[model samples]
Target: MTAPTRAAPAREWADAFAAASNEDPEIQAHGKYFTCTYLLDATERSYAIKMESGRVTEVTVDPGPLDVPYEFAIRATPETWRGFGEPVPPPMHHGIWAATFQRDMRLDGNILVLMQNLRCVTRQIELLRTVGSPV
Candidate 1:
Protein backbone atom coordinates (compact mmCIF):
# COMPACT_ATOMS: atom_id res chain seq x y z
CA MET A 1 0.00 0.00 0.00
CA THR A 2 1.11 3.58 -0.63
CA ALA A 3 2.41 5.43 2.40
CA PRO A 4 0.09 7.89 4.11
CA THR A 5 0.64 11.64 4.02
CA ARG A 6 3.50 13.31 5.85
CA ALA A 7 1.09 15.54 7.75
CA ALA A 8 -2.16 13.72 7.49
CA PRO A 9 -5.23 15.07 9.25
CA ALA A 10 -5.92 14.12 12.86
CA ARG A 11 -8.86 11.98 11.82
CA GLU A 12 -6.53 9.71 9.91
CA TRP A 13 -4.20 9.33 12.83
CA ALA A 14 -7.07 8.74 15.22
CA ASP A 15 -8.57 6.11 12.99
CA ALA A 16 -5.26 4.34 12.63
CA PHE A 17 -4.79 4.44 16.37
CA ALA A 18 -8.20 2.98 16.97
CA ALA A 19 -7.68 0.17 14.49
CA ALA A 20 -4.24 -0.64 15.86
CA SER A 21 -5.42 -0.51 19.44
CA ASN A 22 -8.28 -2.86 18.70
CA GLU A 23 -5.87 -5.42 17.35
CA ASP A 24 -3.36 -5.06 20.19
CA PRO A 25 -4.09 -7.32 23.11
CA GLU A 26 -2.03 -5.21 25.44
CA ILE A 27 -3.93 -2.08 24.54
CA GLN A 28 -7.25 -3.87 24.74
CA ALA A 29 -6.46 -5.20 28.17
CA HIS A 30 -5.24 -1.93 29.57
CA GLY A 31 -7.63 0.33 27.69
CA LYS A 32 -10.47 -0.54 29.99
CA TYR A 33 -8.99 1.73 32.62
CA PHE A 34 -9.03 4.61 30.18
CA THR A 35 -12.35 6.12 29.27
CA CYS A 36 -12.01 9.72 28.32
CA THR A 37 -11.27 12.11 25.50
CA TYR A 38 -7.69 13.19 24.97
CA LEU A 39 -6.44 16.05 22.89
CA LEU A 40 -3.50 15.79 20.56
CA ASP A 41 -2.08 19.15 19.61
CA ALA A 42 0.26 18.91 16.67
CA THR A 43 1.20 22.56 17.04
CA GLU A 44 -0.44 23.53 13.75
CA ARG A 45 -3.49 21.32 14.15
CA SER A 46 -5.41 19.45 16.79
CA TYR A 47 -7.51 16.30 17.22
CA ALA A 48 -9.41 14.45 19.87
CA ILE A 49 -9.70 10.76 20.53
CA LYS A 50 -12.58 9.45 22.58
CA MET A 51 -12.20 6.09 24.23
CA GLU A 52 -15.09 4.24 25.81
CA SER A 53 -14.53 1.09 27.81
CA GLY A 54 -11.16 0.58 26.16
CA ARG A 55 -12.47 1.03 22.63
CA VAL A 56 -11.99 4.08 20.49
CA THR A 57 -15.47 5.29 19.71
CA GLU A 58 -14.74 8.59 18.03
CA VAL A 59 -11.94 10.65 16.53
CA THR A 60 -12.53 14.28 15.78
CA VAL A 61 -10.09 16.32 13.72
CA ASP A 62 -9.59 20.02 14.29
CA PRO A 63 -12.00 19.81 17.17
CA GLY A 64 -13.19 23.09 18.54
CA PRO A 65 -12.45 24.18 22.11
CA LEU A 66 -15.86 23.13 23.41
CA ASP A 67 -16.19 20.08 21.22
CA VAL A 68 -14.72 17.79 23.85
CA PRO A 69 -13.77 17.95 27.48
CA TYR A 70 -10.43 16.26 27.19
CA GLU A 71 -8.96 14.61 30.24
CA PHE A 72 -5.50 15.65 29.10
CA ALA A 73 -3.64 17.15 26.19
CA ILE A 74 -0.39 16.16 24.59
CA ARG A 75 1.40 18.84 22.63
CA ALA A 76 4.48 18.64 20.48
CA THR A 77 6.07 20.43 17.59
CA PRO A 78 5.35 19.01 14.14
CA GLU A 79 9.03 18.20 13.81
CA THR A 80 9.00 16.35 17.09
CA TRP A 81 5.83 14.50 16.11
CA ARG A 82 7.42 13.43 12.82
CA GLY A 83 10.25 11.91 14.77
CA PHE A 84 7.89 10.02 17.07
CA GLY A 85 6.05 8.71 14.01
CA GLU A 86 9.15 6.96 12.68
CA PRO A 87 8.91 3.18 12.32
CA VAL A 88 11.84 2.82 14.64
CA PRO A 89 12.13 6.05 16.48
CA PRO A 90 15.48 7.11 17.87
CA PRO A 91 16.20 7.72 21.53
CA MET A 92 14.04 10.39 23.13
CA HIS A 93 11.62 9.99 20.25
CA HIS A 94 10.69 6.42 21.02
CA GLY A 95 8.11 7.17 23.71
CA ILE A 96 6.08 9.96 25.20
CA TRP A 97 7.97 9.95 28.51
CA ALA A 98 11.26 10.12 26.66
CA ALA A 99 10.04 12.98 24.53
CA THR A 100 8.64 14.77 27.57
CA PHE A 101 11.91 14.37 29.44
CA GLN A 102 13.88 15.50 26.40
CA ARG A 103 11.66 18.57 26.04
CA ASP A 104 10.27 17.40 22.74
CA MET A 105 6.72 16.82 23.97
CA ARG A 106 4.50 18.35 26.59
CA LEU A 107 1.57 17.01 28.57
CA ASP A 108 -1.02 19.38 29.87
CA GLY A 109 -3.98 18.98 32.23
CA ASN A 110 -4.61 15.80 34.19
CA ILE A 111 -1.21 14.18 34.40
CA LEU A 112 -2.51 11.45 36.65
CA VAL A 113 -4.86 10.29 33.92
CA LEU A 114 -2.07 10.19 31.41
CA MET A 115 0.07 8.14 33.74
CA GLN A 116 -2.75 5.72 34.40
CA ASN A 117 -3.14 5.10 30.69
CA LEU A 118 0.49 5.34 29.66
CA ARG A 119 0.61 1.92 28.04
CA CYS A 120 -2.42 2.53 25.87
CA VAL A 121 -1.11 5.95 24.96
CA THR A 122 2.29 4.56 24.07
CA ARG A 123 0.79 1.91 21.86
CA GLN A 124 -1.33 4.52 20.15
CA ILE A 125 1.76 6.55 19.49
CA GLU A 126 3.66 3.57 18.15
CA LEU A 127 0.83 3.01 15.72
CA LEU A 128 1.51 6.48 14.38
CA ARG A 129 4.50 5.19 12.48
CA THR A 130 2.25 2.91 10.52
CA VAL A 131 -0.06 5.70 9.42
CA GLY A 132 2.13 8.78 9.27
CA SER A 133 5.21 9.26 7.10
CA PRO A 134 8.06 11.66 7.72
CA VAL A 135 7.54 15.22 6.61
Candidate 2:
Protein backbone atom coordinates (compact mmCIF):
# COMPACT_ATOMS: atom_id res chain seq x y z
CA MET A 1 0.00 0.00 0.00
CA THR A 2 1.06 3.59 -0.52
CA ALA A 3 1.94 5.85 2.34
CA PRO A 4 -0.72 8.26 3.54
CA THR A 5 -0.63 11.63 1.82
CA ARG A 6 0.49 14.64 3.78
CA ALA A 7 0.18 18.37 3.49
CA ALA A 8 3.18 20.43 2.56
CA PRO A 9 5.12 22.34 5.20
CA ALA A 10 4.14 25.95 5.87
CA ARG A 11 6.79 27.53 3.68
CA GLU A 12 6.21 25.21 0.75
CA TRP A 13 2.49 25.69 1.07
CA ALA A 14 3.05 29.43 1.04
CA ASP A 15 5.11 29.32 -2.15
CA ALA A 16 2.66 27.05 -3.89
CA PHE A 17 -0.26 29.23 -2.89
CA ALA A 18 1.48 32.30 -4.20
CA ALA A 19 2.25 30.66 -7.51
CA ALA A 20 -1.24 29.27 -7.82
CA SER A 21 -2.86 32.61 -7.09
CA ASN A 22 -0.64 34.42 -9.58
CA GLU A 23 -1.33 31.90 -12.31
CA ASP A 24 -5.05 31.39 -11.81
CA PRO A 25 -7.08 32.48 -14.81
CA GLU A 26 -10.14 33.52 -12.84
CA ILE A 27 -8.16 35.57 -10.38
CA GLN A 28 -6.22 37.32 -13.13
CA ALA A 29 -9.32 37.92 -15.19
CA HIS A 30 -11.38 39.65 -12.51
CA GLY A 31 -8.64 40.62 -10.09
CA LYS A 32 -7.43 43.58 -12.10
CA TYR A 33 -8.27 45.73 -9.08
CA PHE A 34 -8.00 43.08 -6.42
CA THR A 35 -5.46 44.59 -4.09
CA CYS A 36 -5.47 43.71 -0.42
CA THR A 37 -3.76 42.01 2.49
CA TYR A 38 -5.45 39.42 4.63
CA LEU A 39 -4.62 36.88 7.27
CA LEU A 40 -5.38 33.18 7.33
CA ASP A 41 -5.22 31.93 10.91
CA ALA A 42 -5.28 28.17 11.24
CA THR A 43 -4.89 28.09 15.03
CA GLU A 44 -1.49 26.40 14.78
CA ARG A 45 -0.13 28.61 11.99
CA SER A 46 -0.96 31.81 10.15
CA TYR A 47 -0.26 33.36 6.79
CA ALA A 48 -0.34 36.99 5.72
CA ILE A 49 -1.06 37.22 2.02
CA LYS A 50 -0.62 40.43 0.10
CA MET A 51 -2.15 40.81 -3.30
CA GLU A 52 -1.47 43.66 -5.66
CA SER A 53 -3.27 44.17 -8.93
CA GLY A 54 -4.14 40.52 -9.45
CA ARG A 55 -0.79 39.10 -8.36
CA VAL A 56 0.45 37.72 -5.09
CA THR A 57 3.22 40.00 -3.91
CA GLU A 58 4.19 38.26 -0.69
CA VAL A 59 3.12 35.52 1.66
CA THR A 60 4.37 35.79 5.22
CA VAL A 61 4.17 32.50 7.04
CA ASP A 62 3.69 32.52 10.79
CA PRO A 63 4.38 36.20 11.03
CA GLY A 64 4.59 37.80 14.41
CA PRO A 65 1.60 39.73 15.79
CA LEU A 66 3.25 43.00 14.86
CA ASP A 67 5.15 41.88 11.76
CA VAL A 68 2.37 42.33 9.27
CA PRO A 69 -0.87 44.27 9.06
CA TYR A 70 -3.99 43.06 7.30
CA GLU A 71 -7.44 44.41 6.60
CA PHE A 72 -9.23 41.14 7.29
CA ALA A 73 -8.63 37.72 8.78
CA ILE A 74 -10.16 34.28 8.32
CA ARG A 75 -9.55 32.02 11.27
CA ALA A 76 -10.43 28.46 12.19
CA THR A 77 -9.33 25.46 14.16
CA PRO A 78 -6.80 23.27 12.37
CA GLU A 79 -9.42 20.58 12.03
CA THR A 80 -11.75 22.95 10.24
CA TRP A 81 -8.91 24.03 7.98
CA ARG A 82 -8.13 20.44 7.08
CA GLY A 83 -11.63 20.21 5.68
CA PHE A 84 -10.86 23.16 3.47
CA GLY A 85 -7.65 21.61 2.17
CA GLU A 86 -9.38 18.60 0.74
CA PRO A 87 -9.54 18.16 -3.03
CA VAL A 88 -13.30 18.20 -2.72
CA PRO A 89 -14.44 19.43 0.65
CA PRO A 90 -17.57 17.89 2.14
CA PRO A 91 -20.64 19.61 3.53
CA MET A 92 -20.05 22.89 5.32
CA HIS A 93 -16.34 22.96 4.53
CA HIS A 94 -17.00 23.75 0.90
CA GLY A 95 -16.95 27.54 1.23
CA ILE A 96 -16.24 30.31 3.70
CA TRP A 97 -19.89 31.21 4.27
CA ALA A 98 -20.89 27.65 5.02
CA ALA A 99 -17.88 27.07 7.23
CA THR A 100 -18.47 30.32 9.13
CA PHE A 101 -22.00 29.36 10.03
CA GLN A 102 -21.61 25.62 10.39
CA ARG A 103 -18.13 25.18 11.81
CA ASP A 104 -15.50 26.96 13.90
CA MET A 105 -14.34 29.35 11.20
CA ARG A 106 -14.40 33.06 11.95
CA LEU A 107 -14.11 36.10 9.79
CA ASP A 108 -12.51 38.89 11.72
CA GLY A 109 -11.28 42.46 11.29
CA ASN A 110 -12.50 44.60 8.41
CA ILE A 111 -14.80 42.20 6.63
CA LEU A 112 -15.45 44.83 4.01
CA VAL A 113 -12.09 44.19 2.43
CA LEU A 114 -13.04 40.57 2.16
CA MET A 115 -16.27 41.47 0.43
CA GLN A 116 -14.47 43.94 -1.76
CA ASN A 117 -12.19 41.25 -3.12
CA LEU A 118 -14.70 38.50 -2.68
CA ARG A 119 -14.17 36.86 -6.04
CA CYS A 120 -10.40 36.74 -5.89
CA VAL A 121 -10.37 35.82 -2.23
CA THR A 122 -12.71 32.93 -2.85
CA ARG A 123 -10.48 31.64 -5.60
CA GLN A 124 -7.45 32.15 -3.41
CA ILE A 125 -9.00 30.11 -0.62
CA GLU A 126 -9.71 27.30 -3.06
CA LEU A 127 -6.01 27.22 -3.78
CA LEU A 128 -5.78 25.18 -0.61
CA ARG A 129 -7.12 22.25 -2.60
CA THR A 130 -3.87 22.32 -4.54
CA VAL A 131 -1.37 23.58 -1.94
CA GLY A 132 -2.98 21.93 1.08
CA SER A 133 -3.00 23.26 4.62
CA PRO A 134 -0.02 24.87 6.33
CA VAL A 135 -0.67 23.27 9.69
TM-score of each: 0.86, 0.93
Error of 2 at 103 (Å): 4.1
Per-residue CA lDDT of model 2 for 73-134, tens digit only, reads: 99998888888888998788878999999858899999988998998999988888887866
Off by over 4 Å in 2: 1-5
How many residue-pair clashes does candidate 1 contain?
0
Candidate 1 C-alpha lDDT tens digits along 1-135: 988667655556667767776787878888877788898888787778888878888878788889788999999988888888788887788888888898878999999988888888888888777767322
Model 1 is weakest, by summed lDDT over 10 consecutive residues, at 126-135
* Model 2: colliding residue pairs: none
Model 2 TM-score relative to the real fold: 0.93
Quote the positional error of residue 18 for candidate 2 in Å: 0.3
User: Per-residue error at 37 for model 2, in Å?
Assistant: 0.8
Query: Judged by TM-score, which candidate is best?
Result: 2
Q: How many residue pairs clash per model?
A: 0, 0
